[model samples]
Target: MKITEQEVHSVAEIARLELTQEEGQKITHALQVILEQTEALKRLEISKVKPTVYVLPLQNVFSEDQLDKCLTQEQALGNAPEVEKGCFKVPRII
Candidate 1:
């Protein structure tokens, strides 16, 4: 689980990153710790445990969509900055 400076440098090169000597050393140590922790976790026995996407039960909190009254075209365009042909006029985007 030990991470080497060479490995850190290789990853940095692949990611197009320019790491300083100190940064590379720090990253190497951090990666070593993470890998060690992951190795420790892999030792756990979870054969009897059921797989779950979430720890807690979840339910939809939103109300069902329903048809509702809509504003008239004139009412909808009343506050528009600019209107043309009974619709909002937007700047051309080509």
Candidate 2:
């Protein structure tokens, strides 16, 4: 699982990154370490462990939805800096 200098350069090109020689070497070494660590983890035995989606149980904490009255059009538009034809107006994009 050794990462090579060429591989690092290839990845840098794909990402449109400009890496100095020292930075490229450092990245290659770091990638090698990560791959080695992942390989080590793959050797661990966890056959008896149960699969879990979350580390802790999750519950909905929000209150139930209730019908509510909304503001009228004039009330909603009252704070607008600019309004036209009963709606907010802004500069044309095109």
Candidate 3:
């Protein structure tokens, strides 16, 4: 697709940007070059290639889940300096 200076101006207006004539022309040319470069990529053969979220194989690295013995609430708060209504009490922040 060919990019035009008018298109650049339109985009600039939408972005609330004030581009000089030179900057607009430069941006238009740059966009045109980018589009032209992408044209070569359009010729790649991918008929047999399946679309994927990842380009490489991915696997879970996490360990297996298992139930184990845990401390009770009374044991957990056994060493607390302050405990109020079965909860730890911290200094109030201003």
Candidate 4:
């Protein structure tokens, strides 16, 4: 499918994009190519293929979360430039 200049301009307006005439032409051509490729892909034979989310094999590789010895308040705030009531203190924000 070919994307027209007017169609590109309307799409850009809806998307709030500011495209020059040259940019609009480039985008239109790219969109047309993408549409053609998608249409060609629709003709592929996949009757026996399963509709899977991932193209490759998937596996979980994460380790179980474990807690370690944590720092004391004084040790945690020791590097702060300012400390008050055993905690780091900073300028107030609205």
Candidate 5:
């Protein structure tokens, strides 16, 4: 697939980038090469291959949940910069 310099320029506009004519030409050629490689991949035979979320055979690694001692409310707000009504107070974010 051939990408045009105009298309590259449009992308630059969307990304708020300022590019020289040389940079636009380079980006256009690079995008064309990348698209061609993907197009070539469409001809590969992979009907029997299974799709995977990752390359590895991943398994759940989480440990079983167990009851544990809990901290008091004061402990949680101990190192807070500001406290109001026994709770941490942070600047309102509008």
Candidate 6:
């Protein structure tokens, strides 16, 4: 899992990245540590633990629907830039 500067440079060449020599060495070491950590995770024992879908309990706390007063046709269409035959006239797409 240990990545070297030559491997990082090869990957950078494939990805079209122009990393400096110092940056390439830094990236190689960082990538090596990440792979080592992932490898270490494989050694953990969790066979007796049950898998969980949600981390926290979820519940609906919304209020019930209620009726309300509505606006008239003239009030709703008052802000239209163009109207024809009691309806808004929009530009045709096709």
Q: Which candidate achieves the best TM-score against the true structure?
A: 3
Tens digit of lDDT per residue, candidate 3, span 1-94?
8888998999999999999999999889989999999999779998888888887787776866888889898998999999999899899969
Model 2, residue 60: distance off in Å is: 17
Rate residue 35 of model 4 by lDDT.
Answer: 89
Residue-level lDDT of model 2, residues 29-49, one tens digit each, is: 998988988999668897888
**Which portions of model 6 miss their true places by more than 4 Å?**
45-94
Residue 3, candidate 1: how far off, in angstroms?
Answer: 1.2
Q: Please say which candidate is ahead in TM-score: 2 or 6.
A: 2
3-72 per-residue lDDT for model 4 (tens digits):
7988999989999999999999999998998888899867999898889898779778687799888999
Q: What's the C-alpha lDDT at position 29 in model 5? A: 87
Give the higher-TM-score candidate: 3 or 5. 3
RMSD (Å) per prediction: 9.1, 8.1, 12.3, 8.4, 7.3, 11.4
Give, for candidate 5, the lowest lDDT window spanning 10 residues.
55-64
Q: Estimate each model's TM-score.
A: 0.48, 0.47, 0.50, 0.46, 0.48, 0.45
Rank all candidate structures by their TM-score, best first, as comma-separated numbers: 3, 5, 1, 2, 4, 6
Candidate 2: regions farther than 4 A off: 46-94
- Kindly report which residue stretches of model 4 are placed more than 4 angstroms away from their true locations once superposed: 46-94
Per residue, candidate 6 scores C-alpha lDDT tens digits across 8-85 of: 999999999999999998999899889998998678897887787877777676876987878887887899999888
Per-residue error for 29 in candidate 4, Å, reads 0.7
lDDT of 1 by residue, 7-75 (tens): 999989999999999999999998888898899867899888888888778867686699889999999
lDDT of 5 by residue, 1-94 (tens): 6789998999899999999999998888888989998998779898988887788777887867998878788898899998999889999878
Q: lDDT value for candidate 3? A: 0.91
Give the alpha-carbon lDDT of every model.
0.91, 0.90, 0.91, 0.89, 0.89, 0.88
